[model samples]
Target: MERLNAFDIRELERLCPGGVKENVSLAAISRWQIGGTADVIVEPSSVAELCSLRAFIAQEGLPSVVIGDTSNLLFSDEGLRAVCIRLGSRMSSVHIENDIVHAQAGVWVPFLARKIMSAGLTGAEHTCGIPGTLGGLICMNGGSQRKGVGSSVVTVESVDTAGNICHRSVEQCEFSYRSSVYQNNSEVIASAKLSFLSGDKLKIRQEMLSILAERNRKFPRKLPNCGSVFKSNPAMYEKAGPPGAIIESLGFKGACCGGAQVSPHHANFIVNTGVARARDVLTLVSKISRCVLESVGHHIEPEFKFVSVHGEIMPVDEMLKGFFYE
Candidate 1:
């Protein structure tokens, strides 16, 4: 609370009105259900309010972090000492005009996929079961079946650190396997304009159902966990197969550290057995990385982002560079 003075909270309340909250539980917001409290949480109802809040934070030099659905984030056990700006239900809006779709950052991926499918759009069939928001999905260029959302991205709108809205074409996004320019920048995504091919609704629905069925058969849905713990490297896949298969070959399935366990169903997922801590998850990540490196001469990157107490977000593997040697 030392970082956020009473005056700051009052000002934030005035800016965002009913969207501001104090001492909110991060565990309740995170997919892993494993974080401590945050001093302040703000959900801007409109792009205008978000711009104002961003400007104020920049002007006052306040520590702040923006999150979408929190589906791929692992927050610290120690409470965050910054303002948490969550783009969620308030900002989740979708509009479609012919084959073009405009969606806000907070629209859930699954819901967005259904909307697109209903509109008879073809490109979003792969995102039908992703448990995240459009902001995070585009930030990570995420999709299943080796297809990325970047394929349909026509333009992206984001708010810079200075609160200026910026628009960029798909090329400027620098989309790659499980990454985008947003991952390395300070800008927060506001919305996106995407183009899709016209398709038969029945065919699209069948494709989405197939993908969902395969996911359900392979993934652990009964437990609380981030979707994937390791990024799938194309080169590594050719050399050693996918991360899940490799981790399973190394006997890591059902492995446990504190209350965190390597999912018995999917080797790439680390699940919370009711009570888990950030340290436990990181320990498992470090152990998995060490094993992978020792066995395959490949350093697998993590797909999940870890948010520290200071609001700094980094990949678990990057944070554990020294852990490899120790």
Candidate 2:
């Protein structure tokens, strides 16, 4: 991995112009609010700008990563040391044409859900409370109520590491339960066109509101935390229970390791108590994984992705493999 510096920042500025920022706080951008400063951050306002910047990065053989909202990610205490390309508010745009929706990668999932609902769309109600961007949701096939956003996807557009644009249909996306082909590739999701069905606007609004209220009542709201810590496996659910229920049954609810604690409201969530470090969260995760595997004879996998200081990202469970309870 290549480390960015003042010289690299200047070159990046020339490549993308006004979309460059330096020495940004990772904690400020991350939902968990618990990381050190990032050396450089770039927010491309358009696909052209993103392509130019990405091409420059590839030409220079520099370390780079793409992120949106940071809702399900955890960064190291040492922070990110590469060029962080953030697709966010500047790139957010949602266009509705009848039952079809064209949404940019940065469009917030909840906001997009509401937009679809207001347009009499029914398939998006399940996403009304997910706190990630459209790109992240698509990559993870994320949604509440066991319904995935991938189900509504018609076509997806992405930019590869070499700055080449690619398009794929829903079938080509290879979406499964909480998984997608993007998880196995280096492609950056740019935008997507989703298909929906017509419904009563009033009925859609009521359902979305009801889902939001239930989420608000069930999840912790006062602290900084990523949504769910563990992914619920279908086999585990049938044999034992959901991740939250299984964790709670093991007396791990409210369990704390330093400043990080398993949320009392939802045992599957690990909340930062004002001063939690990345290490603290990892400790609690290891404890949970080890205890569950030993007690219930099943391994619970993490839903969160861990971002290392070197800008390498991987599933938290994979990173902790063979090192649990250390």
Candidate 3:
């Protein structure tokens, strides 16, 4: 990691007002609460500030990473050696204009869903229970198998690697199952305009409540977890069923490795039993993959977003290289 000189720090303070925090604990910023410190952390209050920070990182040739709410992510015990920018409460705003909702990327998706429902908006009710920021959800194409955030996205506003703002229509977003144009890009979403249908406010509220209730029953969030570990393979999903059922069929539910355990309530989830380390989770996931391959003869692919060992946030595909199981 390139060390931020005194001038860089001063400039950051000048732009953000809030001084840069050095050696910040990544664990404190994540949902799993189990990572080490990052070399540098910056809180950018708004999209303009984020753009400025991104440009500074580029000019200084420093590795930088953007995180939102940290729900679907898990950092390593080794921590991050790069600049980390978190869009704090300052950027979380929402506005309604006729049938469209304009929301900052930092807005909490579930909370935004409720606000939209209160405004008599439909089509995003399924997001009421999704615990991720709007940017994170849009980046991951987050939602149920049948419905997703992509359907409601009318336009996306993002900053490129050069810190230049660009807006793209829904047609240019390249949204697919669990992915979008930004999936592997060095860009950050600033805000998005989502189109919604007018609906009965009371009916929308009830639908959101029901969705939340169903998610609570099926996802088992009483303990810490990164949602499902794998996306159900299409062939198996149509034939044998989802990854959870395939895992349960092997009687691997309630399986444990140190403090990490496969959730008894949901076979696909590896929940923190109490104090699971990043290593423990990786160990259990590797064991599950091996067992499934040996018994079911189908290589189940994992759906992890972040799991780093070198103190850098890389794609899960590259980060899993050193592990015994691919």
All candidates' lDDT scores?
0.91, 0.89, 0.80
TM-scores, in order shown? 0.97, 0.97, 0.93
| Candidate 1 residue-wise lDDT, 94-203, digit = tens | 99999999999999999999999999889899999999989999998999888999999999999988889999999999999888999989888999999999999999
TM-score winner between candidates 1 and 3: 1
Clash pairs for candidate 2: none
- Whichever of 2 and 3 has more TM-score, that candidate is 2
If the candidates were sorted by their TM-score against the true structure, best first, what order would they fall in? 1, 2, 3
RMSD of 2: 1.3
Ranking by lDDT: 1, 2, 3
Positional deviation of residue 102's Cα in model 3 after best superposition, in angstroms:
0.5
Per-residue lDDT tens digits of candidate 2, residues 23-92? 8888887999989988888988888888888888899888888889899899989988878988888888
